[model samples]
Target: MLDIGIIGASGYTGGELMRLLLSHPQARVELATSRRLMGQKVSATHTHLKDMVDIQFENPDPHEIKDRCDVVFVAVPHGTAMNIVPKILDDKVKVIDLSADYRLKPAVFEDVYGIKHLDPRNVVYGMPELHPEIKHEGFIANPGCFPTGATLAAAPLAQASMIDSVVFDSKTGVSGAGIEPSQASHYPNMAENVQPYKLTKHRHLPEFTQELQRLDKNLTNISFTPHIIPSVRGILTTAHIFTKGTLTKYDVMDLYTEMYQDKPFVRMMDGIPSLSAVKGSNFCDIGFEVDPRNNRVVVISAIDNLVKGASGQAIQNMNIMCGLDETTGLWVPGIAP
Candidate 1:
């Protein structure tokens, strides 16, 4: 069994990772670290795992973590992972950093994040459907939740280089904002209300731009606007993708099917996909319609913000990196209402 260690074990992503890894057949959580909650039971923070996971949170040195784990997931904030990851990478421990740390070119990362990238290197962007070759890599930079859903929605059209402009309007759960409470995520403000923030600029925008460009280098005009919804666990994205030429419904469907046919997590739906269908599962449900009059294809994509968007995807990357079947711990269906 692979010994896995998590750098930050108290946040939503970390808790979700612990819950998923506990049941993994080939890997187990060997170390869960939280400086403030050091020595506290992991279940104390993640109440649902009370009896299932018996490990306590321990704040161990990054260098020491290298010896304890064969694979490590750096689940800390944006700038923090760069610091810890560099220390642990020297001992041959495979790593997947779930932050915006290494997902872009050094210059692009600094531009989008507005912070100098202290450590920049070529790491596979961990979106399994787009880059299945992650199966052989030792380190991966997990994609952000919004980018995960948005990219899958537009990837097929983008790959064909048929897109002239794409507008992604994504509605995300409050949990994506993390454990820290904010005025935006407050119960009163978020309940019965939909507020759009970062309308013109969001950090995840760069990831969408960078990844899509790989499929077609001459593409431009990618816009993103994100809103916080009342829900607690999903992201539903509507991608308005403009095509360079007219295409029938049959044509669009054929493209997506051919692109995602080999990918297990990306499901092509006959009708529109709903959040409930992918809430707890490691699947991205995609559906689309061709608008002949407007020359646009409206694509809808749904994923659980914490699962397929984060922890579940992280584990998926781990399984691939370790040469286990990609669905080793994540083939279960989502809970639907």
Candidate 2:
């Protein structure tokens, strides 16, 4: 069995990690750290995981985690992971970080994050379906929530050289903002509203564009926008893509179907998929329509922002890194309203 530790275990992503890992057949939760809730029982902060795990949240200390587990999932924010990851890179442990710290090349990292990377060359992007071969690498950088939905929707088109340009508009739940209480995410403002924030400067933009460019160098002129809805979970991304060649809607559908044929997590639907359909599960459901008159194709994808978008994907990477079944502990169905 692989022993797993999670850093930053008080937030939405960390709680989701605890929920999923509690049922994993071959994995055990050894330690989960949270600076805010140190020494508190895991169940105290996240009632959903109350009886599922008996572990307590601890403070972030590399020495405490390195000796207790074979792998670690860093669920902390961007700048924080950089400070902790480098210290825990001994040969005994593998790490999957669910932050934007090492998702891009050093130059691109600097451009988007506005910081010179302290160690950029050692980490690989951790979207398993997109980069399966790199799963065994020592360190992995999990993709952002918005990028996960957007990239899966447009990857097939980008890979086929069929898309000329792409515009992505993502609507996600307020929980994606994290467990912290902010004025924007306060119940009064978010309860009955759909607000569009981060118009052009969402941090996920560079990670999204960089991955698409990796698949097709000709993929240029991409635009992305993200919004926050009042819901508690899920991300719905719509990609407006201009095709380069003559391809019908059926052709585009076929491309996505074939591309994800062997992949178990991506679900291709005939009609548009709703956010509730994929909530609480690690599935990315995609559907698209053709706008022949405008020479465009519209692709829509949905995922539970906290699950597939963050902690679930981090666990998927851990399974791959450890040579276990990729779907080991993540086969639960979506929770319906």
Candidate 3:
């Protein structure tokens, strides 16, 4: 069994990784670290995993982790991962970082993050659907939540060179903001409200543009707008796409079906997908409608913000990296209301 270490295990992504890894059959949890919750029981921070994990939250020490784990999942914030990943790389421990630190090229990374990238050569952007070959390589930089959904929604069209400009309007849950409570995510402030933030400049913008461009160099323009809904989890991304050539709705659906036919996590639906359909699972349900009236197409996609957006995708990468079935330990059905 592959021994796994989770660095920065106090936040929602880290806790979710713990919950998922505990049940992973081919892997074992070796270490879980958190700076603030050091020495505290894992269950104390996330009560949902009370009986599942008896491990305590330890301090972030690369040496300690390198001694125990064959691979490490760095679930920390963006800039923080860059500081320690270089040292971990020296130990030859494979890493899957759920941060934007190394998602783009050094120039794009610096431009979007406004920070110089310390180690650009060692990391690969970790969007399994887009770059499945990267799994054979070592280090991975997991895509952002919004990029995960948006990219998946538009990838088929981009691959076919059928789309002109794509406009992504995504609605995400409060949990996407992270576990560190903020005023915008406060109960009263979020309840019964739909607020659109990060209108012009969101970090995920560069990621989406960069990834899509990899598929089609002519795919130049994208308008991505993200909103925070009152829900606790899940993301619903609606992409308003202008097709360059004539294509029927059925044709677009067939293209997606053919593209993701082998991908276990992607579910192509006949009707539009809702958040409830994908919550708590690794599945990304996609559906689309043809707007011949305006010669446009509306593509809808949904995924659990914490699952496909974070922990589940991370585990999927691990499965691929370890040469296990990608669907292993990810068979849970979506939780219904």
Candidate 4:
């Protein structure tokens, strides 16, 4: 079994990593680090994983972490990862950062997130379905939750260069914000209502731009708007993909199916995808329809923002980096109610 460490293991994504990796057949949790929750049992911070793991939260020392773990997942915020990752990264240990630090180029990252890169370097964008060659790399930058769902929803169309303008409207759960309590995440503010934040821009905007531009350089018409719903987990992205010419529903379905046929985690839905259908699982359920009158093909993609969107996808990246089955710890069906 491979020994793994999770830095910043007190937040939603970190707790999720603890939950998923505790059961991973080939990976064992060796260390779970949190600067604030030091010495506390990991399960104490993540009550949901109370009986699932036995590690305590320790303050991170990059050198010690490198010596202890075969692989490490950095679950800290965007700016926080650059501090830890720059210290421990080398060929002796593999790193997967679930942060935006390494997802975009220095200029673009600084422009979007309004921050400077202290230790910028190239790392594979960890979306195994889109870029399975992630298997060949030692370090990976996990895509943002919003970008993962939105990109998968519209990538096929972008690649075919059949699009004119693409507008992505995504509804995400509160958990996507993180484990920290926030004025935005306040129960009364979020309950029985939907609030749309980042109307024209979000930090995840650059990720979609980088990935899609790889397929078609001239495709500049990408727009994303995100909303927060009252739910605890999941992101549903409705991509209003306008094509250069009219295409039938059958044609678009074939395109997505052909692209994702061999990808295990991306499930092509026969009908519209439901949030409940993909909740608590590492599946991205994609369903679409063609509105011939307006030349609009509405594609809906759903995923548990904490699963396929974050921790589960992180584990998927580790699986690829270690030359294991991409779905090793994450092939189970969703916990549909």
**Top lDDT hit:** 1
- Model 2 residue 182 CA deviation (Å) reads 1.2
Over 1-337, each residue of candidate 1 has an lDDT whose tens digit, in order, gives: 9999999989999999988887788888999999999988999889999998899999988778998999999999988888888888863799999998999888888888788888888889999999978977889999999999999999999999899999999999999999999998999999999999999989999999999999989887999999999999999999999999898999999999999999999999999999999988999999998999989999999999999999999999999988899999899999988
Q: Whole-model lDDT for model 3 versus the true structure?
A: 0.88
Q: List the residue pairs that clash in candidate 2.
A: none
Off-target runs (Cα >4 Å) in candidate 3 are 90-92
Note the Cα lDDT for every prediction shown: 0.92, 0.87, 0.88, 0.89
List candidate 4 segments past 4 Å from native. none
Minimum summed lDDT over a 10-residue window in model 2 is located at 115-124
Residue 102 deviation, candidate 2, in Å?
Answer: 0.7
lDDT of 2 at 141: 91
Residue 77 of model 1 has an lDDT of 91
**Each candidate structure's count of clashing pairs:** 0, 0, 0, 0
| Clash pairs (backbone) in predicted model 4 | none
What TM-score goes with each of the models? 0.98, 0.96, 0.97, 0.98
lDDT score of residue 1 within candidate 4: 90
How many clashing pairs does model 2 include? 0
Using TM-score as the yardstick, the better of models 2 and 4 is: 4
